[model samples]
Target: MIGPNLIPVGIAGLGSYSPKRILTNWDLEQIVETSDEWIFQRTGIRERRIAEDGEDSGKMGAVAALRALEDAKLSSDRIDLILCATTTPDKPFPTTACHIQNAIGAKNAGGFDINSACSGFVFAFNTAAQFIATGMAKRVLVVGTEKLSTILNYEDRNTCILFGDGAGAMVLSPLDEAGRGEYLGGSIQTEGGKDDVLEVPAGGSTLPTDKRVLEAGLNKMVMGGNRVYRFAVSTFVKLVRQAVEPYGFEQLGRIVPHQVNQRIIESALEKLDLPPETAFSNIHKFGNTSAASVPMAFDEAYREDCLIKGKLACSVAFGAGLSWGHFLVRW
Candidate 1:
């Protein structure tokens, strides 16, 4: 139950950025011998974006942040904090949040990064809402940005065909007086002992960057695809059911899930006995952008009128680290 004294937080604005480069399945045919029919049939992705030179996570994130600030009509200096969710940081030392802070001129903002992989955006958004609810911050910028192309193994058709590069951002602020939209509540969870199902094996303390790691392609992402698909299908249904239990499923306006795969989303919705249109998805256009998928889809849904004001909507994601999370907003 919500406390009367607590400040209500809501999404004030949203924006997204995708690189100009489009990698089509036909294009993949030239590089990896994968057919367009096969890829679309299996993953429901025909193409995805690839960042150009110099378009790292920080650069793309800043672009998205600027658009979000513009949409919010809020000055950069007004952001009290920035929480960036990413698996691919521009560099190991300087947090990507700091880079975004400088780029967007959010000089008054304190910033940090969260690396929950695809689920990072939901986790970051929930964390940002807490700051607003507690009176710790009036406004916060939450960003989920990634340049997965930097670490993708083009030769590995299994993983390469399913990922992309992009960024999405949202500005969270106190719900306005008499406004209908407000954050409800949600959950972030991890099924431990399953990290090995999806991960990049090297470039960290456990498996430091080295010539052997490079030769073995440990720096690139690896996944047990079948295992992940099964887990995602079941978990997506479970999270959505749990989130809507308090409000009832019929009250859900839309579901913005991690755009990992079209098949996964469709299958999950099927299990819930819902129609295909119940969920909003652009995986066919952007593929799997990990952390960026949820926010990007959210931005698209709002712009396209899929999300209705005063109705509850759920954002869910699952990815590397074997992590998954979901959050609800009445918007």
Candidate 2:
């Protein structure tokens, strides 16, 4: 078992990045059989960022990481480890984290990428926290980024309207206090049976890309919207209760959930008896950036002073792998 005197890990800084190119709902009308009203009513997304053709997952992650390092008043050389979580990587080999390391000039730090769908950031956070708590690393950079627009099928209204491109990052370091500064309390669960509900149909080793497969657009994300929605609502409520209740946060200050959809957020709030305002949502501005959504919302909250010192904040997310988890932090 871990010792009670173990070093406490706290978030030293936070940052996020969204491409300047905006893709509004009006852009969808020309491509799919949907209108702004229909998409807005169902998903609460009006616009989302689309990375430029030259920008890939690695570059976006690097941008966000640099901002985080700046916020911490630390340089890249000071970092001990870098963990980049993403579903869309520049390539399978070199590891996206390595690319970010190169971009940021963190020559001393070595890291890798994690592919846990939306639960990726939380997983990476937990992993980095362990390293800090155990004295393996002094400072670690955890980033979640994606260029989903590249893999999305613009013709499919249902899925296309639900995704966007962006990145978010955090600097985790050991805290002097015990049980202070971003103490995460929750369990991570995955139901492989429901994995098929949301997935990219092809293009990996199981189904390598080919001319015929390319023509059929097999590399794009395909989601069963209704099924995933049902699972998300249920999981969000359960994880929130489990994480905050034990800590006695009956009046939890803020909840930064994954910006998947407005409806899903409302459903989870209703089930948890939380007021609509208790949840911080930017789906309208950034769509579902998957793993990046929670941290992106966090950076916005901090900038707007929505998360005050001593306030209890909870971050929750659910996604493919049918995976879900929660992290509670005292700012």
Candidate 3:
């Protein structure tokens, strides 16, 4: 809860980076037993970005961070904290946030990582806002980067076709009287006991990597698509209403949602009684980028003038861990 003594935080700038290589649905036809029509009808994705040989999560995050700093017209040294949200960190050690700090030359910033699957970006954004709200930070760089391609088993069409590689970033700072956007508040909910619904079953403390595990493709992403789809459809509506209803529908500019699936998003919007264009989505272009999805969509929507100045914009996301989050912004 925000206290009267706490300072308000606002988004200073936004940026996103998508890899150059485009993997079309037709390409998936060659890779797996799926056709373009089948995939698009189900997920509303026609193509997705594939990171190049040298593009890792850290590098992608750094690029997006630099772009965000440029957009904000602020230097990296001004950042007080760096928060990165990702399921696919460049490495388990040192944290992807550390790599980004070094790469971006954020010499004065302390950094860390947050892993909440696809809900990660919203989680990280809320955490960043707290540091600023408490006056511990004046500028916080929040990044959501994922090199999901690294952990995918391409042969498995179910999960492989649903994710891509990318990064998105935003600079959050204490709101000033003239600030263009304000971070209003947010809500988050997590349902445990559903970790098996979507997970990378191995390479963790519970299931350390082994020769046998590697042979079984245990490190690759596994998902119960139907279950996740149902959860997303319902939870998306709940989260949007929870964050947006208090402010009223007419006051909202746009809903930036985690680009998980086109069908899921559409279903939720229908249930919420919102217009088709009420929410902006790029899943058709980038598939589900996990934590990177929401921020990436934010960047695109802002650039396209979908999120207008002096208007309210809300971001919502959900993923593995059965976790979901939403944040309200007055832009």
Best by TM-score: 3
| Model with the higher TM-score, candidate 1 or 2 | 1
Query: Where does model 1 exceed 4 Å of error?
Result: 177-181
Show where candidate 2 strays beyond 4 Å.
1-3, 177-180
lDDT of 2 at 238: 86
Off by over 4 Å in 3: none
Candidate 3 lDDT tens digits, 1-331:
3569999888898999999999999998987999999899999999999999889999999999999999898999999999999999998999999999999899999999999999999999999999999999899999999999999999999988899999999999988821866888997779999977999999999999999999999999988759998899989998888887787888988889999999998999899889989989989999999999998999999899888777789899999998999899899
Q: Lowest-scoring 10 consecutive residues by lDDT in candidate 1?
A: 177-186
Question: What TM-score does candidate 1 get on C-alpha atoms?
Answer: 0.97
For each candidate, give its TM-score against the true structure: 0.97, 0.96, 0.98
Candidate 2 pairs with clashing backbones: 310-331
What lDDT score goes with residue 243 in model 1? 90
Candidate 1 lDDT for residue 152? 88
**How many steric clashes does model 3 contain?**
1
Each model's lDDT = 0.90, 0.86, 0.92
**What is the C-alpha local distance difference test score of candidate 1?**
0.90
Worst 10 residues of 3 by lDDT: 174-183
